[model samples]
Target: AQSVTQPDIHITVSEGASLELRCNYSYGATPYLFWYVQSPGQGLQLLLKYFSGDTLVQGIKGFEAEFKRSQSSFNLRKPSVHWSDAAEYFCAVGRLGGYNKLIFGAGTRLAVHP
Candidate 1:
């Protein structure tokens, strides 16, 4: 079975600080990796995704992530955090066989302090 795991359930960081969210996965083969962010009571928005090519990928909202196939991990990172960036982050994995069935981790809630 394929699964996604996020080590942190919640994270608190002061405004303008740096941020990094960890993600790990188990799959039979190379799987599609993605990071998504959701505001309070809002739908999720894609932060980044790794499909096939390069080891690093960038996405909207000033976010980026590096794909490490060796460790079966794709971690999300941001150089600086803002109060507006406070939200729940989820790591997900999918199969490239057109399954489109995204398996999401429990999620990590980020709190930004002033």
Candidate 2:
């Protein structure tokens, strides 16, 4: 069974400051990982994903993530934070082969401050 873990329950960052959100996964083999962001009362929107090839992937809204197999981690980073970026972020790992079933972490709530 595959699972994802987001250690940070909540994160607070000031506008224009750099931000990083941690994510870890457990899987038997190379896993398909993804980062998604959700605004209040909205659906989750895909931020980035790592399936194969590049270990470093770019996402929307100036977000990027690096996949480190050794640590079994895929952490999201943003060079500068914005007030509008405040939202709940989710890390997910999808099973290969079959359907689009994704195991998601508990989620990390991001709060932006001035």
Candidate 3:
């Protein structure tokens, strides 16, 4: 079955520090990878996606991810995290001709300390 797994259930980091969120997927073929952020009581915002082509993909809020097919991983990275960046991050995987249903991970809560 095609699914996504976020190893870290939650993470706490200091403000202005680098952050990396791990994501692993189990899919038969190279599927569409995406990173999304959800604030408290708010809808999820698409960070980035990787269909095919360049392995390194950039996204909004100064976030980026690298798709490693061999590893079946698409990890999200941020150079410097801000207080506003403290939210729930989700890793999702889907195909081109699927039901358009996005299967989200358990989610990784990021806590930023000033």
Candidate 4:
């Protein structure tokens, strides 16, 4: 089965520091990669996604991800993280020609420090 793994269960970053969240997936072919952010009591919000085309894709809230097929990874990055960016981030994978279902990772909790 195709699955996603977020190596970091939790991460801490300074308010103005850059952030990078690692994600790896297992699949036979190139699959869709997505980064979703969930605030304290809110539902998941799509931060960014990589379906095809450009390897590097930009997302909302200054988030971006690079799809490295060889590495089977799609890592999310931000230039400078804000305190409000503290949230749970999930990496998801979707099949190209399947139903609208997604396989999600355990999620990486991000903590922002002053």
| C-alpha TM-scores of all predictions | 0.95, 0.95, 0.95, 0.95
Off by over 4 Å in 4: 96-98
Residue 6 accuracy (lDDT) in model 3: 98
lDDT of 4: 0.93
lDDT of 4 by residue, 1-114 (tens): 688999999999999999999999997666988999999899999999898899999999999999999899999999999999999999999865658689999999999999
Candidate 4, clashing residue pairs? none
lDDT of 2 by residue, 1-114 (tens): 688999999999999999999999998776999999999999999999999998999999999999999999999999999999999999999866778788999999999999
Q: How many backbone clashes does candidate 4 have?
A: 0
TM-score of 2: 0.95
Model 1 stretches astray by more than 4 angstroms: none
lDDT per residue (tens digit) for residues 29-96 in model 1? 77899999999889999898899898889999889999999898999999999999999999999865
State in Å the error of residue 111, model 1: 0.3
Q: Give the better candidate number (1 or 3) by lDDT.
A: 3
* Candidate 3 off by > 4 Å: none
**Cα misplacement distance, residue 34 of candidate 3 (Å):** 0.4
Q: Candidate 4 at 72: error in angstroms?
A: 0.2
Model 4: residue 13 alpha-carbon error in angstroms = 0.6
Specify the highest-lDDT model's number. Answer: 2
